[model samples]
Target: MMRNVAILGASGYTGAELVRLIAGHRGLRIAALSADRKAGMRMGEVFPHLRHLDLPPLVRIDEIDMGAIDLVFCALPHATSQAVIASLPRDMKIVDLSADFRLRDAAEYRRWYGQPHAAPELQAEAVYGLTEFYRDEIRAARLVAGTGCNAATGQYALRPLIAAGLIDLDEIVMDLKCGVSGAGRSLKENLLHAELSEGWHPYAVGGIHRHLGEFDQEFSALAGRPVEVQFTPHLVPGNRGILATCYVRGAAGDIHAALAGAYADEPFVLTLPMGEVPSTRHVRGSNYCHLGVVEDRRAGRAIVVAALDNLTKGSSGQALQNANLMLSLEETEGLTMAPLFP
Candidate 1:
């Protein structure tokens, strides 16, 4: 049976990516697409790359017919999805690609995002949308909150090691480089071509990045105690991808074994061989995460690296994967395309 789906905020980067992936999906049909400012515009007009697809014209959220849709992919900006999702039909299944509901604690959301959650009740109900770790819960959840692209990249490198007690809980650091598209399609002075081109620098310095809330919440839950990783994210001049290098105090061989064993069966996460690292170029433009481990000269230290297209595996692609599981369709449907390589 074909499932009718909608993409809210369909004019943004993640929204456009969702449309591109769903265009190739067999089980899902695009029923409605919403974009407040771009309402009434053809999707192709907003994203010329997606013009080739036969898709619904953009409309206001209220203009969408809820009764005709089976699922929704809420790609709205951070801090905005709470109210919009709260207004949607209560019984509807949704996958949100925003930070609104990823943290289970409303207070934590407020601390990180600087405002009260508009829908605390719904916040408590949302399952974290790291599809591989929460597959069963996502399969049963009415709402699934997508992780930050930086957070997802870090987690793929560290989650299994943390769970298996292979890495030091007290000493962990992650330095990440992300493509500009991860900032969304919105206009900002710093994101202009003249400003961002030919250079790279870190943002959300210190312990301030909002995705830290997710890292703290999830890593703590996995280890049964508090685990805080020093995380810094750098914006690269390129178009789309994330590379996270995690430094940890652990034997290199054990870290590799634990990660390999953990993701051996996961369809979207690939664990590369020992001493070989992954490149963002390898996983660009697809729903895949490539992980690699390397030994540091310091005997007790190791470097674990992860790479993926932040727009795809880290955000929109991850959203579609959760949507597939929620609807009881094949988990890899529309998501198995091999990572785009040069």
Candidate 2:
């Protein structure tokens, strides 16, 4: 039987990507799509790239009948997702692509997001949706919180090293470059064509980015102690993908072996041959994460780089990945589409 799914805030970048990916899914059907301000408009009109597929017209959240939905994918904005989800049926399986349920502690959520959580109980119950590290938890969870795209990319580089105690926890660093779509389809002066096309600038420097909260929570829990990674994010002028370069204190070969062993069974994360670097163009538009490792001339340092499509593996694709586990569907079903390359 085909399970019907509802996509909230479906007019945004991740939401549209969800529709795109779901178009290939055999066990699920998009039964509802909601876009508040764009209500009554066709998804085709809001995003012409999705016009060819036949889909339900966009509607407001209040107008949707959730009783018919077997699963819900919340692609709404951070603060907004909490309120919308709090009102959802308790039995509705959900995969949230927002920051609302990602943090385990409401106080931590308040500290990082500058506001109190609207749904603390849900926060406590939600499973961290990394898909790889938290796979078992996700399979049993009714609600799964997707990791931040940048956080997801950086963790792919460092998680195995941290778990295996192969790197210096005190000297970890991550420099991330993300394409414009990671910012979603919002209207921003900085995201403008003339203003951004020829320029690349770093925003949220000095450990101030919200994704740091995710890294702090996840890494610390993994290390069984406080683990902090200095993270700085830069916005590149392209339209998709995230490339995270991680610096750690470990042998290059050892780091390569650790990452390879960790993801050897993972369908989406690929550890490339040692000394080989990955390009964002190679994983663009697909739910694949490519990682590369190299040794610095300095005897004790290794450079690990990981790349993935922020819209896919980072956000929507990841959301779908978690949803598959929650629904008892094939883990890689609807996600086996190969990465798009030039």
Candidate 3:
């Protein structure tokens, strides 16, 4: 029996990605698609690349019949998803690709998003959807919140090291570079082709970026105390992928061993041979994360770098992985694509 899935905000980048992946999935069908402003338009009209797939016409969320949909993928904007999902049938499993339910604390949500959470009850119910770390939780969760792309990259680099106690948690720094699509399909003056084409610059400096809420929550929880790392994100001129360079106080060999041991059995995570770092181009358009460890000249310092596609592994693809778990299907059923290399 094929499961019927609905994609809210179907016109956005992540939503289109969901469509792309689902079109190839053998057990899932695109039953409904919603785009508030693009209602009544065919998905092909908005995303020409998806024209080949036969899909439902885009409609507003209110027009969707929840009875026919088994799963809902909410790719709506941050604040919008909460209100919309709140009104849906309580039993429908949701994989939200928005920031609304990612943070556990409502206060933290307000602090970063500048508004009280409209659905605190649902916020409390949402499981953080870092597929590798929260696999069991996601498998049983009714609502799963997809991680921030940059946060995902940094965590993949540091989580294993922190969990194994191989690094000095106090002296950690994460420097990340992301492609433009991570900003979403929204039109902004800074993301315009002319301005973003040939230049690169850092935004959200000084721990001001909202995704830190996730880093603070997940890392601190793992360390059993407060853990704060200097995180800086820069926008590169490319269209997809994220490469994060993490500096930690630890021996290079230990960092390599910890990562290798942690991800040895995991399918999507690849810890490269020591001293061989990953590049964004290698993991582009795939649900794979590659990590490399190298020793710094300073005896107690090491460099850990990770690469992944910001859109795939970091967002929509992650959402689909969580959805597969919640539905009791094989986790890697539809995510077998190899990275597209130049």
Instruction: Give one digit per residue, the lDDT tens place, for model 2 in 215-252.
Output: 99989999999998998999999999899999889888
Q: What is the lDDT of candidate 2?
A: 0.93
lDDT of 3 by residue, 1-342 (tens): 799999999999999999988888988999999998899999999999999989999998888999999999999998998998899999999999999999999999999889999999999999999999999999999999999999999999999988889899889999999999999999899999899998888999999999999999999999999999999999999999999999999989989999999999988999999999999999988889999999999988999999999989999889988999999898987888999989
lDDT for every model? 0.94, 0.93, 0.94
- lDDT value, candidate 3, whole model: 0.94
- Write down the worst ten-residue block by lDDT for model 3: 327-336
Which segments of model 1 are wrong by more than 4 Å? Answer: none
State which candidate, 1 or 2, has the greater lDDT. Answer: 1
Q: When superposed on Cα atoms, how far off is each prediction in RMSD?
A: 0.7, 0.8, 0.7
Clashing pairs in model 1? Answer: none
The regions of model 3 sitting more than 4 angstroms off are none
